[model samples]
Target: MLIVTGYVQVEPTELAQFCNEFSALATATRRRSGNLSYSAAVDDPQDGRLLVVEQWEDQASLSAHLEAADTVAFVDRWRGRMLGNIEKYDASNKRGLMD
Candidate 1:
């Protein structure tokens, strides 16, 4: 499995609109094939920092998601609105105590 974690920051004034847009995107992403899970959390509402965590079946699934038109459009639209660069980590699943 593939896990992805990231944060995107926006202007405080654009927080509400960004959340609204992300809500729709998250819903669509979760419904896609090969998607294990997808979610967004508000790290600091006042700072407009948003955190994203996602799981996928594999690299292929992640790649498909990245190429999705809606995903591309969302990124393009929000790129300029971002307060800074989006930080991301791509990781592979490893044995855990629960597993």
Candidate 2:
């Protein structure tokens, strides 16, 4: 499994638009094959901080997502308007913490 996490800070004035665009992207991403989950949460509306979390079956799936045209376009569109850090983790040794 692969886990991706990140946070992006946008201009407060642009928050609503950002969320709207992200909602569309997330909706599409969720329907892709090998996608375990994808979401963005507003950590601080005042600061326009959005926390992003994504899970995929593996690196290939994640790579495909990154290379997808919509994903590319979204990133390009927001590149200049957002500041963030994104990181990926490999978790092949699965564990059930709840169990």
Model 1 lDDT tens row, 1-99: 777877889998999999999899999999999998998889999999988888888788888999999999998999878854444455664678789
What does the lDDT come to for candidate 1? 0.85
Measured with C-alpha atoms, the lDDT of residue 87 in candidate 1 is 41
- Model 1 misplaced stretches (Cα beyond 4 Å): 83-99
List CA RMSD, all candidates.
2.3, 1.1
lDDT of 2 at 93: 81
List model 2 lDDT by residue over 1-99, tens digit each: 899999999999999999999999999999999999999999999999999999999888898999999999999999999999989998878879985
TM-score of each: 0.84, 0.93
Q: In model 1, what lDDT does residue 64 have?
A: 94
The lDDT of each candidate is 0.85, 0.94
